[model samples]
Target: MQIRKKIYWSLCVLLLAACRQSPPPSRPNPVLQLREMGQLATTEYELSKVVRARDEATWYKIGERRMLVSCRARIKAGIDLSQIRDIDIQAQGDKISIKLPAPQILTFSIPPENIRVVYSDVGLFRTPFSQAETNAIMQQAEKQIRRQADSLNMLQKAQEGAAVFVRNFFEQAGYKEVTITYRYQENAS
Candidate 1:
C-alpha cells in the first residue's frame, strides 16, 4: 500500500509540472517602438495666402506691372519620433515617463493645382508677367505661409495632440501612469 501511495504522489507531481504554462513572449521595447514610428503627424491644416506685387514705373522702367496670386498650402505638424532616445523613455512598474522633442511643421506643400491667379494687371507699356515671374511670386507666398505657422497655433495644437497620443499609447501598453514632456527646440515651427 505504501508503494502504491508513493507512485500516485509522484505521478501527480509529474503531471503538475508538465501542465505548468510557459512564460509569455517578451514584448518589443517601447522606446524602440516609438523611434521606429519616425515622425508622428498629429495635425493637418489647409491654408491659403494671397500675395500681391507691384513694380512701380521707375525712371528706367517703362510702365508699372502688378500681379496678385493666391496659393493654398497644406501643413502637417508633429513630433519627430526618430529623435527619441532610449534615455528619453523610462518605465518603472506600471508608470512611464517620456521626453519628446518639441513639435514642428513636418510637411508644407503648395500643390500646383491649388494655386490660382486671383487677379493680374499689366500696364499697356509693360509686358505681361512671365511664367518665371509667376513662379517667383508663388515661392514668396510659400515662404509667407511657413512664417505664419507659428501665429496659426499649429505647433501648440500638435504638441497637445502628441501628448494625448503618447499617453494613450502607454496606457494601452499596460502603463497606469504616463507622463510626457517636451524638449524645447529653437526654430521649431
Candidate 2:
C-alpha cells in the first residue's frame, strides 16, 4: 500500500508537470510596422477649400429640381513612408540618397459637423431634398475638391516636405550629405 501510494503521487506530479508548457512567443503588431521600419509620413499640405455643387434634373419639361450645396473639404496630401524599402536608402560614407514614393492625397475629410449649410434651395414645384439627395451633394462636393487639388499646389508641397523630412531623418542617422529624389509614376498627382 505504501509503494502504491508513492507511485500514484509520483504519477500525479508528472501529469501536472506535463500539462504545463512555456508560453508562446508574442506576435508583432502589424499597425506598428511602419514605425518599426523608421518610416514616417510627412504631410505638408492641409488645404481647406470651399466647394459648390449644383444638381439639376428636369422631368417632362414641366418639373424641375435643383440643389446647390456649399461646403468645405479638408485635404491632406503626403507620401506614404511604408512604400520605402531598405534598398531605397543608400548611404555611402557621409552621403545618402533615397528614392521616395510619389506624393498623394492622404486623407480627404468633410465632417458632417464641420460642413456648414450656407444655403439650401428647393424650387416651388420640386419636392424637398431627401437624404439621398443630400448625400449626393456631399459626394459631388468631394469631387470638386479633388479636381482643385492640383490648383492648390498640394502635390508639390507634399513632395517638398517629404524631401525635407527624409533629409532630416538621414541627417539624424549620422549622414551629412543627403540627396532625396522622388520616383516618378505615370498619372501621379
Candidate 3:
C-alpha cells in the first residue's frame, strides 16, 4: 500500500506538469523588419540626352573645337527604410499604419557603354576633343539629369511603388488592413 501511494502521487505530478500551458510565441515587430530592409529601390529611370561642348576660336589658336555626346543616365529612386522611427509605425489588432520618409534618388549612373561621340568638328588649326574634355561634358549631362528628376516624376512613381509593397508585405504578415503615408519634404530627389 505504501508503494502504491507513492506511485499514484508521482503519476499525478507528471500529468499536471504535462498539462501546464507554455507561454504563447511572441510575434516579431514589423517596424523592425522594415528598418532592416534599408534602402528600398522602387523605381528606375533611363534618360538619354545629347550634350554639347564648344571651345571658341582664340587669337593664338586660330580655330574652334566642338563635340556632341549622346549619353544615357540611369536613376534609381526609393524610400530609405532605415530612416523609419519607432513612431512611424502603429499597430492596432489586425490593422497597421506606417508613415514612410519622402522618396529620393538612391543612385545615379551613366554607363560607359551607353555613351557615344555622336558628332565632332575641329578647324585645321584647333586641337581635337580629348578624352578628358569628353568626360567633363558627360559629367555636365549627369548633373542636368539630376536637376530634371522632379520633372520626370521619379519620386512620385517611387512613392507609389513603395506604398504597394508595404500593403502587400503587411497583408502577408497577417495584417487585415494597412495604411501607408509619406512625410512631407521641402525638396525631393
lDDT agreement with native, every candidate: 0.87, 0.72, 0.87
Better-scoring candidate (lDDT), 1 or 2: 1
Clash number for each model: 0, 0, 0
Which portions of model 2 show Cα errors greater than 4 Å? 1-40, 44-68, 123-125, 185-189
- The prediction achieving the highest TM-score against the true structure is 3
lDDT of 2 by residue, 1-189 (tens): 999999999999999989967899999777744434333445644445454544464444444445555555666777888888897788889998888888887777777776656666666666777888778777777776677766877778888888987788889989999988887842254
> Which ranges in model 1 have alpha carbons more than 4 Å from their true place?
1-37, 185-189
Per-residue alpha-carbon lDDT of candidate 1 for residues 42-122, written as tens digits (9 for 90 to 100): 999998778888878477878788888878889999999999999899999998999899888888889999998989888
The TM-score values for the models, in the order shown, are: 0.69, 0.61, 0.72
Better of 2 and 3 by lDDT: 3
Model 3 alpha-carbon miss at residue 124, Å = 1.2
Where is model 3 more than 4 Å wrong at Cα? 1-37, 185-189
Ranking by lDDT: 3, 1, 2
lDDT of 3 by residue, 47-82 (tens): 988888888846677788888899888889999999
Worst 10 residues of 1 by lDDT: 28-37
